[model samples]
Target: MAWPNPFRRRTAKTVSHYGYTFEWTDEHLSEEDAHKLRFTYDELADRVLARLDAISPPQKQPPSATATSTTEKASSVESEQSKPASRDLYALLRDNKDSDPVLRELWDQVTTVPEWVDWPQIGRGQDVFYRYGGPNLTGLAYQALLGGMGGARVVETLARTGGFSIKVARRRLFETTQHVLQVTRSLDALEPGKGEGFESTVRVRLLHAAVRKRILGLAQARPSYYSVAEHGVPINDLDSAATIATFSSTLIWLSLPRQGIFMRSAEAADYIAMWRYVAYLIGAPTDFFSTPSRAKAFMQSVFLYEIRPTQTSVLLANNIITALHHQPPGYASAEFLSASARWLNGPQLSDALQLPRVSLYYSLLMLGQCAFFAFVSYTYRAVDAWDRKKIEVLRKVFWQVVVESRYGLEGKTTDFDFNGPGLILWGLFQHVVRPQLHWSEISRCRSCFKLLPARESTRMYGVHALII
Candidate 1:
């Protein structure tokens, strides 16, 4: 007899995100206005978009904050910023700060640190990631991206770029991990003009611009291909803002707590601050993610605003799991991934994405997995002697254990190469060397107490970060 196709549609047309969707409005703006901005894309990156002769710059129609006329995009042809394309963005900013009008203006904007930024808190925030590194990563892959497939509009843009395509899933995952790592690599990694975080974030900004232009070009070529009126700009401001929330607020409110891990109020705030700076650098609307409460509300408001999954959502979600099966830091099976995705995202959303049902064995294994992380987290949190300095030590340990191991994976990298301009190579490890860590560890960590299975020289799934 023939088997069933998990990719087949599971009737998600009427489904909605089960989470509470709050109405978002700050003192300065209303929900109605934010909706208008939702259809908007970044305008500052228009100059870089002009250089690509292969595509036309997207016109944001008329009478909107995001609206950019073709004449304005074409006007860049005469601007000095459109000179040689080979010059790296960082070096261009350094060497031609005086010459490039675009970089100069952006430089002044991003470099001037906001008075509210608290460096010590940011440092502790970095620790929060590594503090529960394993479960947090599981949260990222299973909850943030895979479960995030519910956002139909975001998936619309992702589908257009073939980003979550079966072949590109691991690359996309690792690249995102690297961006998180770089920005949180160290307290000083965000030092405006001279840090890895600063440089990489800016590169991502340019990449976002490029993608927006590419899609806008496609929509322009074939009107039926994409609807700006219906879908908004390629990567509109709301989309970008929501993207940042997935990495931060989603982790704090949804991903971590669901896995039996929870951050204290302070840790949550600092973590939000780290991503808030990232929002600023990436040109996402920042005030929305300014504090823990604000970020949570924005995330909830976004779920209310979007989260209607479609057939494409099912395809992309399953495709990511299939592509990354038996691969990477977590050499997880499709069943293992589905189980975790289901747990982290709950049954309602998982059902909408058409995630296959796993046996109770996998569920118990997940329970064991959460128990292990809770042990580690509880130990760390209970250690009264473990001060901010200990957190710093933990950060270094994470750098050595996880980050260092990732570097030489098939001679890939323990560090990012900024010698180039684009963010294409951010997730190069998938291509450079795809190491099969320890998918067995998911089971092992679950059964570590009783069975004590012999760990194959590699590490386990999400339990890669050993507190030692």
Candidate 2:
């Protein structure tokens, strides 16, 4: 027989078997042998622990008094340097430039002189043009809107363009080169005669990185609502983030020594003009008026007693003839005539053309125009009788005009611009003026009275004259 296969197993059935029986080859290991090859949990745990114990512990260090003292001294030096320098606005302006001989001489005298920082707060009206006065073109534009020229499109356009220009200047110019110079100057000043080193350079780089990151964060949060075409080339995709970053960086550059000395001076002049324009729009405080209060009061008396009476007669004559066609039958004609006469004779009308009251008058003019439009629609049953589609479109335009008008009314003139006025005027022309002048080409003309010459005002006014 061939040699038996040692790994082979044999199985058999027996008549008197006590249990199922099986046979293994001699080459196969027994159960006890298999168990001997394996390690128990206890043995594995011991082996791992023994290996870990073989590694050595790190050595400890003792405290050093000299090193501690050095650290304390370094911290004290840092604290001294951290204190901000006392800034003199005038001196700050002078130290930056020696190129202008006139300014250089002026700067020399300014250093020895004392000046008011907050001139407006100190009751010095002439000093309001100074940088510290807090009123500028931006503030003036805001005030003008509050006075009633709430032209949303125009304000918004101006704000967007102006903001973008400022943004571009700050990002491409101030933040990059000028900011670096400022940082270097600050570092040099802090070190006395010592030059800036690698450490300061690294710190400046880190600060720039942080500022850029903040700027990026703002840009990502408030993406531009307007198109690149709207802002122009420099600030094509400028968004709120870019705007905030630019503003912050510009403010920083302006505050730096020497960099913004001349720029700030020029800006001060612009600020005054802006403030005056704004003051004109909103009716300035009584104290700001050139004439005395008594003089203004006397003028009011003259206007009410003399000038107004003549105007009233003219208005009465016009209303009497116009009322027959426009007014409903019965007491309507009489009531409108009486109201017209009363309004012409009213103290409010006299005050309307005066300082302070001009704002009120403008407001009333706008309101009356709106009310007259509404009255015409009601009288002709035009709005209520319109098709659903026309009504919906009109409704949308109405709300848009109203909301933008109100925004313009609020002191948010910077929020809109000329475009806003155009849009409102367009809406009014489409909804109100269009219906009344459907037969005339003049009525349909979008730019009818916008820039018409003074001579054409009467002719154009007649062309769009309301039946009401």
Candidate 3:
């Protein structure tokens, strides 16, 4: 059913950007390259084969080890050759559709790959994330749409942390912006260890692992408050992780197209492919959706099956809007943020989050901003090479506003004071009081009423346990 993109033009041609010309086709990749793009069978099969060999190996050593090895290799090659040559996921998905009725039904009426699966262009046009007003727009979109609607469990966790609220909100926001930028850079390159290796890969991995550890510890300490059914299994399970990851991948692409920061079908494919690889590295399940269309499907599934907003969702959204309102540069206002939330999430969700109704002035300003960016996004490509300096300045200007937002308010002060007895007692409770509950055998299962893990001493439990 799928071949050579028959739905599109097939005439041999050249396209040029920045004096560079390249062919556009589904065949941009060689067969070997396509194989490289997908998963490898040898890795998975090796583990199962190794276990089988250990249990059922020949008792006697071969008389000639070399001959036995050669025979084994020959058999392996014969088995491989007898099987289908194409083992890539796309191929496997198609081949298994008949036997796997579910797979067939899932993709049953789907055709032509959504008209937006242009991988080649996406790969080459990775600059869209930062070059246009992508950072601001996406940051806004996340606050309004993804974070606003993903239920109480995820947002409530952030709210209770108090890390970004009481301790150091400015620093947290800066770190978040940096993380977004780093991910953008990594996606542009889209290789495991390329371009800011630790920043791109290890940083996020460690952050996610630390988050998991902290959540597990919290659940263990306070079963009454946090539990599997409430928080979702594994704390950050496939569904939640997929939602969070797609916010940056598919959601970003979806948001940008309206603002004139558009990506071709192939460009969207490359963007999603980059994130899929990143999600794998960070230990998030990528099996749900390997393409943008599938990601969109996964998103739709979220609304129908996953999300159920509550009081906690409202509190978290309010917290996010409040924090953004205080940040420097003075642009993110209550009215502005609420209006953007309303526009992005629609009236129903906006009401769910309890966002104030849109203000006329802010709404018009936001609209103007989008229109201006759309103009720039479309026209600037012709002058992109020559406009590097201006683009850099624009990037700097955005960050400058961000920095000002961090520390720019009048009468700003960092001095914090609390009652002396209350302060000392709270410290004692955190360091001295909390430890007793943590070490107590009875306290271990006080909330959940389940057996605690063997290594409880090594784990810490408290609000400050996992800040990063």
Total clashing pairs for each candidate: 2, 16, 10
**Model 2 Cα lDDT, one tens digit per residue, 1-468:** 011235555555211111112232333334353223221112221222223223221122223323557777788688966754422222222343264444344334322212322223221222222221111111111111111112212223323322113222112211122222221222232221122222222222222222223233334566573322222222111111122211122122221111112223333333333222212211121112222222222222212222222332333223222332232111222223223222222233223222122244443432353344334333333334432333333333322322223211111111111110111100001112221222233323323223222332233223222221
All predictions: root-mean-square deviation over Cα?
Answer: 10.6, 38.4, 23.2
Candidate 3 lDDT over 1-468, as tens digits, reads 001232454356543321112344442323343223222211222232233234333133233433557778788687965743321222233455465544354224222223333445444434444455442344334432334344554454554444335234444544444444444542333433334422234333433333444455567888864566545543254433444444444344434643436665665566566555545544455654476666554444334333457776776566556666533323355676666555555455567667788768766755655565555555655575734543454444333333223332212211111100000000000011011123343233222212234344542232111100
Top model number, TM-score: 1
Give the alpha carbon lDDT tens digit for every residue of 144-228 in model 1: 7887788887787788766677765665565666677778888789999888888878767767776776678779999987888
Would you list the rank order by TM-score, best first?
1, 3, 2
Error of 3 at 388 (Å): 6.3
Better of 2 and 3 by lDDT: 3
> What TM-score against the true fold does each predicted structure earn?
0.76, 0.16, 0.54
Model 1 TM-score relative to the real fold:
0.76
Q: TM-score of the candidate numbered 2?
A: 0.16
- Candidate 3: give its CA RMSD in angstroms: 23.2
